[model samples]
Each structure stands twice: as C-alpha cells, then as structure tokens.
Target: MRAFVFPGQGSQAVGMGVAIADASAAAREVFQEVDEALGQNLSRLMADGPADELTLTQNAQPAIMANAIATLRMLEKDGGVRLAAKADYVAGHSLGEYTALCAAGTFDLPTTARLLRLRGQAMQAAVPVGEGAMAALLGVDRDRAETIAGAAVDSILAERGPPLVCTVANDNDPGQVVISGHRAAIERAVALAKEMGAKRALLLPVSAPFHCPLMIDAATAMEAALLDTDLSAPLVPLFCNVDAVAIADPGAIRVALVAQVTGIVRWRESVLAMQAAGVTQVVEFGGKVLAPMVKRTAPDLAAISIVSPAEVEAFAKTL
Candidate 1:
C-alpha cells in the first residue's frame, strides 16, 4: 500500500512551488487560491524571497502547505493521478498535518490555509520571545532523551523555583530528539544530555516553544478555531502526529490536531505505525526533508520525494 506524506516548517524554501506552478494550471490555481485566501501575495514571497521573511512561522506554515498542495495538484492534472485512487493513507509532520487533511479532502484549501494562518499566529504568540527555547538532542533514543529531559527539569527546579516545565518536544528517531522549555533549562539539558552520552545537543532557530505546555495558549486558540470550522470525514485515513494512529473520523482528527499544538510530534512512531500497517511505499509531496527522515527512521520502506512536474510523472509511473 501507499502512504502520502506532507512536510512541515523547515522544508520551506524560496521559490518552493514555482516549478510546479509554472508547469500546470491546476498547480497555479492552488497558489492563486492560497494567495487570495490569506489576502497577501504569499506566492510572491514564495517565488521571490529575502529568505528571512518567508522563514517566519506565519509565512512558513501556509507557504509550505501551498507548495505541497500544488505538488499534489500537479501529480493529479499533469500525471493523471487521483489521490483517492492512488493512495491508501496520508500523513504529515507538525504543521504539515493541516496540509495532509486538505489533501485527504477533510477540508477545502481555503479553510486549511486560513486555519494554518491562525495557527501560526497563535503559536507565535504563545510564548514571549527569548523566554522559551528548543534544542535537538542528537544520537540518543527517546527513552534516554526523556530521562535527560527529566534530569534537566529537576536541575531547573532545584536552581529556580518549583513548576519546572522542560520536556521532550519531538521524538524524531533513535538518533534525534528535540527538547523544549526555558532557555536556561534547555541549555542545561543540552549539557546534561552530552554527559548522559548524547552525541550532540544543539539549539533550534524556532520562534516559539512548540509542542510544550508553553503552547497551551496556541492549543486553546486552535480549539476555538477548530470548533467554528466545518470538517468532513477524510477520503483517506491520516496517520496523526499526536497519537501515531490512523484516524478517519473528522471529529477525532480535529481533536488530535488541537492537542498536537502542545503535543510532541510522534513522527518516529507514526512512521513505524504506517510501516506496520503494510505501507510499502511512502510518497512525500513537495519537499525532500521528510523523505530523508522516513529513510532514516524506517530504512526498509521505499520513499519518494516529488517536487516538480517531472518527479510527479515519475511517481505516477509507480502508481
């Protein structure tokens, strides 16, 4: 079986969807729709960038979604591929969840775009700048990383006051885990993790402390936005990031999405679950980032990254 996946924040680049948009009218329409929905020339920023502006949370969120959706449209219009017919399941990393839901037909493109815009804004506003920070703990398994995080929390509580909040933000793989919380605490964690045998611990250049309690405000905002929006049952099941489970019910998916704002992205577990479900091939739309992660996490699975019309055509041959 085949599983289609979308990429998250760091996958975005200047001129992301331009190739596909230029090659197919269907792809162009996706970009145009996103531009209109957001009431900005996001397409312009995406096509021509100073790089810094497009990398912001608000811009990167919807821009990445637009690129992925445009790639999907290119596969459909130019490569004669139909999502419902070609794929058995869909999934995405972090913010890419919204893009996956849209591709699976749970929500329209406009609603997805608007929802992502609000999500970005809410997440960005969740914590004050420089107060919270995230770091990647490399070459350590999840259990060890969790233990390190716990120790870091203890250290912080001993040094500061009670109510320490450091935690694992992402269990990416056996070799990579991300931790988030207070800046000083995270730095302490990085030092402690190295002592605990982690190969390296490096800070991430993110604007907010995502996937932590610090993002409770973002989660609350998402809950309100989700409640007001309409969600139809998806045509394909989604391997949710929060639960690492295949979810078909729109209501359940909505709840998971809201929780995911403050929940660790179980990307490693999600890919494992997909593998266990007999997904032999994984197709990553638009970006090449997730493909490498999939290969690293599950080397047995065949993975493809499609970013242009020619790549879409190549993928269609497999279908």
Candidate 2:
C-alpha cells in the first residue's frame, strides 16, 4: 500500500510551482482557479515572492495548497498517475490536511482555496501579535517534552491569574517536539526543556501560537465556515492529525478539522500508524518537508518528495 502526503507551512518558496504549471496546462488551470477563487493573483505571489508577503498566514496557507495541487495535476495529466486509483491513504501536516482532502476529492480546488484563506485569517486573528509564540525542543522525547510543558504551564498558573496556555503542539518525530501558547509560558517551557535534558529549545518565527488553547477562537470560526461549506466524503481514508486514525466519514472529517486547530498534531504517531498499516511507500507532493519526517519516523518506508518535473516523472514511472 502507498500513502500520498502533502506538506504544511514553512514549505513555500518563490518559484515553487512554476515549472509544473509551465509544463502542463492542467497544472496552470489549478493555479488560475485558485487565483480566481481568492480574487487575486496568488500565482504571481507564489512564483515571485517578496518573502514577507508570501510568508503572511493568509497567503502561505492557500499558496502551499495550490503548489501541491498543481503538482498533483501535473502528475495526473502528464505522468499518467491518478490519485484515487493509486493512493491507499492520504494525510498531511497542519494546513496540508486541506490539501490532502483536495487530493482525495473531499473538496474542489476553489472551495479548498477559499476555505484555507478563511482558516488562515481565523488562525491569525485568534491571538494578538507578539502575545503568543511557539518553540521547538530538540533531542527531547515526547514524555519529557510533555512534562516540561506541564511544568511551564503550572508555574505560570501559580504566578499568573486567569491561567495561560502552554502545551505540546506538534510531535514531529521521536527527538523533536514543538510547544505553543503564551509567549512567556513558551519561553519558560524553552528554558525548562533545556533543564530537562533537551539538547536545544528555541522559539520559532511563527506569527501566533498554533495547536493550543489560545486558538479556541479560530476553532469556533472554522466551525461556522465548515458548516457553511459543502464537503463530500474523501475518495480515500485520511490519517487525521487529531486522532492518528484513518477516517472517511464527512461529518467526522469536519469535526476533526475543527478540533485540529487547537489540537496537537501527532505527526510522528500518524506516520507510525501508516507504516504499521502496511504502507510501503509514502509519496509527498508539492515540497520535500514531509519526506524527511517520514524518513525519521519510519525509515523502512520508501519516501518520495515530488517537486520538479523530473521528480514527478520519476515518481510516476515507479507507479
């Protein structure tokens, strides 16, 4: 069995999807449809980024999805690869979940673009700038990371009123975990993680604390938006981030989508689950970010990252 995965944020770059779009009209249409849906030239922003603008939450979310979908389109049109027939399961990291759903036919490209635009806005507006932060703890196992996060939150609660949020946001791999919440709490967690035997702990450059209680407002906003949007059942089961299980029900998928806003992204467990389920190959679309994580989590599984036209052709030949 094989799983097709999509990448999340921090994977976008200038000139990401240009080659695929330039090579295939189907790929160009994907970019053009997304641009029309959002009422702006997002393809230009993606291909010729000013860096800061492309990095904005609103832009990055849909841009990453577009690149991934464009790559998928190229694979289908030129490489003779079809997702519904080839992939056994689909999953993604964070915002990449939307892209995975897109690939599985849960949502059309226009709907996915619009939904991601709203999701990015809601996530960004959940907390004030500079008030929330995220930090990565390296060389610390999940158990130690959890203890450090708990201690950081408890210490803040003991000293501060109205309690503050601080907890593990992502379990990226065995040795790397990310914590998110109030800036002070995250800073404390960073310090505590190092004292708890972490090799290093450093704050990330993200705009807001994600996958924590602070994103409740974002979750609520998503609930409303998702209710209004029409989502069909995905063609294949998705290994959800919140549960680390494969689910194909539309209603369950919606619930997971909303909960994932403030829920820890159990990426490591998700990969392990896919591996245990007999996924022999993991094909990562759009970017190379998730392939390394798949390698770190399950080295036995063949991981492929399809980016350029050559890589796409190479991957299709193997299929």
Q: Residues 1-319, candidate 1: write the lDDT tens digits.
A: 9999999888878878888888889999999999999999999999999698998899999999999999998888877878999899999999889999999999999999999999999999999898899999999988998899899888878877775678888888769999988787788898898889899999999888889999999999999999999999989999999999999998999899999998999999999999999998999998988887889999999998999889987877877
Query: Which digits, one per residue and each the tens of the lDDT, describe model 2 over residues 1-319?
Result: 9999999888988887899998889899999999999999999999998888998999999999999999999999888878889999999999999999999999999999999999999999999999999999999878989899889989888897567788899999888899999999899998888778899999998998999999999999999999998889999999999999999999999999999999999999999999999999999999998888889989999998999888888888888
For residue 24, model 1's alpha carbon misses the true position, in angstroms, by 1.5
Q: Each candidate's lDDT (Cα)? A: 0.91, 0.93
Clashes of 2: 0
lDDT of 2: 0.93
Judge candidate 2 at residue 128 and give its lDDT: 99
Query: Which one wins on lDDT?
Result: 2
